[model samples]
Target: MTSSAVDPVRLAGERRRIFLALFSALAIALHALEFLLPSPVPWFRLGFANIFALLALFLYDGRAAWSVNMVRIVVASLFLGTFFSPRFFLSLSGGILATLAMTTSRKLGCEKIGPVGVSVLGACGHSVGQLLCAWWLIVRHDGVWFLLPPLLLIALVTGIINGFVADALLQRLRRHPPFEDIADGAHSDV
Candidate 1:
């Protein structure tokens, strides 16, 4: 009953919000950087923003991750002048769905599989989201299905890279006890 007795629910909510804000800002910055850099491949990106999504999975839960992702996409798009485009919506859909899949899979006791496994799952979900959008909104052609193989391949590669980055960041975050203490205080499900 004492204040020292941490309220797990309150802590969890606070941690979730903090993580969400941090990830959203990170996502926006990454998105802006990608635009400023202007890569050769139009849609291809390092997916630096996804690091936060993966972190959310490990630190919080699926719902928290998804929420953070959605906010990031919307805010990033608005800032990058893509907020109203079909591409923006498509990418958002794909990214959110993918993050959700990865977080959910991890939560289901697949932790042993690690970030690589989660990334692969997320990549698949990303591809699915894109394909759906292409079919329903843009091309409206069955040939779009043919694009899946290559897209999936790209997703796999990028996902792995993103996963590794996330893993590294998580490791670094873990080493900092002050951050961990803040995180625990915010998300203690005790």
Candidate 2:
């Protein structure tokens, strides 16, 4: 007979890593899917993958949410062959700002704020970040600034859609058996 002892901390870390990898993959898939869809403008994106970031923020901690988002952005860029390109930088900037905004808003405990509010904040941050990156790295034109109003309008509409979808997904996951463990683990970390 043989007995082996497993370190609880190590096991938890492994579990976290696995879960984060899965989240990143899901984000990447969503990102790719969004790319396959049609947009009004070349730079416009629905940011559907942000749902995973919201999930990480609401379920896990800010660090985990950041990890998921960064990994997703990097992997998605690599897969799409956009690594190190101007677009890649824009995406990275947007992801960083969105994650920061969402996490900070949650910490601030905004009045009557829910996932929807947080999502909208993140979306707005993302749009601004991308616009700044474009103006600095690509556009370098004063007229580019005019894009802000329209971009913000697009962000508002898409944010509402993303937030509602994320809320619905969260509710369903909470009831599902296989995903229930993930929901539980996420709460325990908080």
Find the candidate with the highest lDDT and give its number.
2
> What are the clashing pairs of model 2?
none
TM-score of 1: 0.83
**What lDDT does the true structure give each of the candidates?**
0.74, 0.81
Clash total of candidate 1: 2
Candidate 2 all-Cα RMSD: 3.9
On residues 9-77, what C-alpha lDDT tens digit does candidate 2 reach at each position? 565566667777888899999998887788779779998899888877776667888998999899889
Which digits, one per residue and each the tens of the lDDT, describe model 1 over residues 34-110? 76896765556666777788777666666767776788788888888889798797887788678867876786745
lDDT of 2: 0.81
- Candidate 1: C-alpha RMSD to true structure equals 3.8
Model 1 worst lDDT run, 10 consecutive residues:
181-190
Q: Show model 2 residue runs off by greater than 4 Å.
A: 1-13, 110-112, 176-190
Q: What TM-score would each prediction reach against the true structure?
A: 0.83, 0.85
